[model samples]
Target: MKRIKWVLGLSLVGVLAVSGTAYALGSGASGMMGQTPQFIRTQNQVGISKMGYGYGMMGNYASSNGAAGYGGNGGGCGGVNNGESYSMMGGPYNAASLGINLTDGQVTTDDQALSLAKAYVQVLNQDLSIDEIHEFNDSYEVELNESKTSNKAFEFLIYKNGGYISSEMGPNAMWNTQYGHMNGRNSGNPGKPTVTAEQASKTAQDYVNQQMGTGYSIEQPEVAPGYYEFMILKDGKDFAELDINGYAGQVWFENWHGPMIKTINNGSTTK
Candidate 1:
């Protein structure tokens, strides 16, 4: 397996506008916070059945259809360890019990979400900074970086309604077998896998074809510790992103990001 190194001084700029929303993109943004437990879908050969609150990256469970699936990394950089949430329903949700007011027509701004994220990071006692911000249909995915080295740390989702945050489900949490939160912070040493990037790409493409229809192409693999993250493109544009387990070849799609509205590269370093 190749070790992926992030260059510190990459000249990432601009707030890309998408779907009529223009976000001010920068690296010097504030923070993130929340706890929305995911109700992950474990797929079978035909479709999906059964939904479970996936907490922690360990343990194995069989879907209602009898397909094996891995749970998500639960406690990471100030995340809940015991599957805590207001709703038993999976996916992102609002936390009214946490005093998050849901006034109609209210949307969370980038600055506000970043502020919440920073506060959450501080609460975890982790020295991390905001690296990137991705706007989706329902939430904003905040990519974090190590404060000292300025290297990519982790990513989390902040729901728009209440700024509720949680560990990103796919590669950042589960498929990242080595640094994944499942084995605890920066624990686990899964080493390399026999499946090459090219092979992983094929597996991802096959999974996509099975789940989705045609006209979709898989991009090059983003090598992680225990899995490979790939971008699904349609007509040469990013459509969705998913990860494949390097050891078991299981597919985990990032279904949280409903639709990407814009991407912000906040290249700021935190002290």
Candidate 2:
């Protein structure tokens, strides 16, 4: 087995903020920073649901039977956010690897909701209570915290439609639609992308080569409220993901797939 040291849900959780590092690519002195045209559309669903390897709970998924990234929005942790896998290094992973395309049932379950809470606490090996469970459109949001002292800081989501109960665990990350608020109030506006898809793709390619020792093919970037989501593929299959700021070409989020490897967060927070 390979040494797959990871933080887990680093998907949705670890990559939230933008890097303030300014690239001097304006004139020939700094180089050419191209314009970012329309957003790059992709076929694969890359939601940081699992906001994070929140994918995390981290499930006991196998690298060989690797699942695609999945996640729901709202707030929470991944290794990408919270903790490590419960059984992954052992066996038996979750079946819920659904990304933002979680359109299955409109059902609800007290047991299902509670299970998510339990899973989270189990992973952290901490004591927690079901703080709250509310219905949000097609998904059920679950909240949890330490059993007694009232620490409502950690939160996650559970999705269900019809009778299909799912947590979509894996190294899935999600872009929290709730990014623009603080203490129950709006914080500020998100920055718009200054670079075009072509420009961002070139930056992403350069990043891939720097990280993986070789360049890989990438699709156009998805324009969210603030960041650009790039779905990287190899041999026409989902291999990795990259999130960069359109305004500054900052790579915000990233995750790779392998024969049972977990996600990694290389201290690339804030930017």
Q: Which candidate leads the pack in lDDT?
A: 1
Q: What shift in Å separates residue 6 of candidate 1 from its native position after superposition?
A: 33
Off by over 4 Å in 1: 1-60, 63-107, 114-129, 145-152, 183-187, 267-271
lDDT of each: 0.48, 0.36
TM-scores of the models, in the given order?
0.55, 0.35
lDDT of 2 by residue, 39-103 (tens): 22111214211111111222121211233332222443322112322221121212132112222
lDDT minimum window of 10 residues, candidate 2? 48-57
lDDT value, candidate 2, whole model: 0.36
lDDT of 1 by residue, 195-252 (tens): 5666557656665665555667787876656667776775665666767556544456
RMSD of 2: 16.9
Candidate 2 Cα misplacement greater than 4 A, ranges: 1-186, 256-271
